[model samples]
Target chain A: MPRVVVDVVLKPEISDPQGQAVLGALGRLGHRGVTGVRQGKHFVLDVEGTPDEAELREIAENLLANPVIEDVELHLSGD
Target chain B: MRIGVVTFPGSLDDVDAARAVRLAGGEVVPLWHADAELPAVDAVVLPGGFSYGDYLRAGAIAARQPLMRAVVDRAHAGMPVLGICNGFQVLCEAGLLPGALTRNSHLHFRNRDQALRVERADTAWTSSYAQGQTITVPVKNGEGRYVAADADLDRIEGEGRVVVRYAGGNPNGSSRDIAGVTSADGRVVGLMPHPEHAVEELTGPSVDGLGFFTSVLQGALSA
Candidate 1:
């Protein structure tokens, strides 16, 4: 089995509404001094067979990363 | 025809998606997120819902599901794939489509019947509709904002991959009012609206969403 790690990040300068909402709520709850908040996700997978880098890149381009406001970094392990 | 609906943990709309597939004159197959097989289905639907509870990010955790590998493979093989709402987010997360869905510009969870223009009706999922036709579909999500680089947006527009655009007003501040898009081959489509919820006239919206399912079916039969 091969492992694939996916790192997803929102682009800089783009407003994060969800993160801002959380920040606002936190401020209301008496937690202050939090200047910025941005949220993203990461995934590590174990798959059945070896996947070529090109195939993985295609996966990242087509299904794993939205080329619009997010960038995806895919690291293949144990290939 | 058999349509497969992939269910990730915390998926809220897979059942409805399956029902929509059945109503659209197709057999429904349930595919688990952990499974690698795509079943013997002619099409696939990545339905709406907060998969993995939107913990890491909306649709981000679910995008890495084991079954998604097969889904990506089959989708690239020209199998028609539709992603609605959260499914759309998953599509973006999985890199099946361009643009990332962010929080609503107003910083709220928007749920409403939105009017959208069918920008490109030639795709497998939208061929039944006329280009520039307006349709209403329900959109509900906290992270439905769509954003992309200007160049990428221009390229998508240039390539005619943009399938739908918000009509009256930008609901979630999507770039260029883009509500839906198709792959280069027009086989895979992802949209930020719940078309399945608006399929029936009794559901309060126009029965325009049914065209998506019908179009895919017709396209499959024709091919």
Candidate 2:
């Protein structure tokens, strides 16, 4: 009953045109104080066993995110 | 001279890929995603489409399928492989090639005849063309922007693994304007363009795409 959550985002150096478009839309809508925004992917995994950091990293590295253009962040709980 | 063409769940180009193979004077062997065996084929072609419904990223799911396992193994053993469009995504996801295809910079699903230069004609999939030759092929996809780490880009560029690049103009904002690449040994190649769709002048911009199929067939025969 262990749970793992992952967030994958484009590397900082890479341009995210979609994210920029969203930011522009937000500005157009008169949303105040939201200076910047970036878009990414999120995944929640319900694994059979307690997945250690390495296992979680392996999942993110191999499947959840592409290492070439995205960086992955992991959160584990419900141990 | 048998070539295997893998058809994933959402593949749209398998038939065209098979036809291209046949036109190139090679036998076509249809491969399924669930099959673990690759059968007896000199080379393999992973056709394109929204495999796995483009969920969890295009090509990520299809790359881990059983058929790709055998294909990847065979590719590593120096067998020739060509991945087109979504298949190119699968190849990169499987680590048979480098980089990844993200959503287009323009945020549009582009479909057009694209001009490309054969940067490395020595590759197995490009043997029919000369280096720096320009050819037209149809490119269609939403997630087709190729990206790689700076070091990786430099490495591939230095090794002459960038097999083809956008010639007339950059279509998808791919890094270094790269449209296709090959492995270190030039046995495995992946590209965003659908050469299968461009093999015939009747339905395509030109018959130039036929060369890729012919190149693979000749490479397999000579190997």
Candidate 3:
């Protein structure tokens, strides 16, 4: 079986308060080396055959992420 | 005039929106999200709610429903459509409007009587409001922050498509303090504030929200 991994993230210019809060917590926990954090969503889809990047891209653009404020990356692998 | 109020599975404000339409002297047509055929109605209102439990992004699932396709078709044909709160999110997702509503910058669920300045009073949903008039309405949401590319923001501002601007203070750090906007034809309006919840003075901060409901009737007559 093949799997498609989709990662959806907010655009670079968008403000991510959730990410900032995580970074704040990291700083408070003494992980001073980490300067920033951006939270996102990840989905792993198991398909019966080859994972089509184009089809996955369409799904990501239309459903997984909002293009106005978010970006998506797809990683494909098989077992 | 007959106004259709869509009741998605999680819709919580459809009743209030229907009541507001009836109060404004329009016949109420209750529409279900699964219904592909939109009944003959002069206008439509997408009331606010956690449709699809806000799954995979708020309003994203509901935007692709069958009824929304019918709505998209009618809206493009010049039918007046108003999307409130979560409905605003759906409108943006459905490409009927520009920009997207992101999480609040402060990361808090804000509920309050919000003051808004009417920026464009010529839209179908805002004709009753004088340009630059201030009105108070109830706004309650966690993901109501309006965001767009800097160029898009400037373009919308330059074109006078901005229908309302937040007054007094920014509630959710929306870019340019924009509270609402209208489509190019000014027939489609989407706002984060819940005007249906403020149509009655006894139950709301003011009856200022009634104008949004009434303005559509006037728009229909003149169109």
lDDT by residue (B1-223, candidate 1, tens digit) is: 8898988988898987887787888888899999867788888999999888887567887887888888888888988899998898888888889877877889778889999999988999999999989999888888888778777888889999899999998888888899998889999999998888877888747777888888988888898
Instruction: State TM-scores per candidate.
Output: 0.80, 0.95, 0.98
Best by DockQ: 3
Error of 1 at B104 (Å): 0.9
lDDT of 1 at A60: 72
Lowest lDDT 10-mer window, candidate 1 chain A?
A61-70
Badly placed stretches (over 4 Å) of model 2 are A48-51
Query: For model 3, what is the error of residue B68's alpha carbon versus the real structure, in angstroms, after optimal superposition?
Result: 0.5
Sort by DockQ, best first.
3, 2, 1
Interface RMSD of each: 3.4, 1.2, 0.7
CAPRI-style class, candidate 2: medium
lDDT of 2 by residue, B83-197 (tens): 9999899999999998889889998999998999999989889999999899999989888998887888899899888988998888888999999999889999999998888
Clashing pairs in 3: none
Better of 1 and 3 by lDDT: 3
Answer with 2 or 3, whichever has the higher lDDT: 3
lDDT of 3 by residue, A1-79 (tens): 6778889999998889999999999999999999999999999888877777888889989999999999888887622
Higher DockQ: candidate 1 or 3? 3
In candidate 3, position B7 carries an lDDT of 95
DockQ for candidate 1, C-alpha atoms:
0.37
**TM-score of candidate 2 against the unseen true structure:** 0.95
Against the correct fold, how does model 1 do in TM-score?
0.80
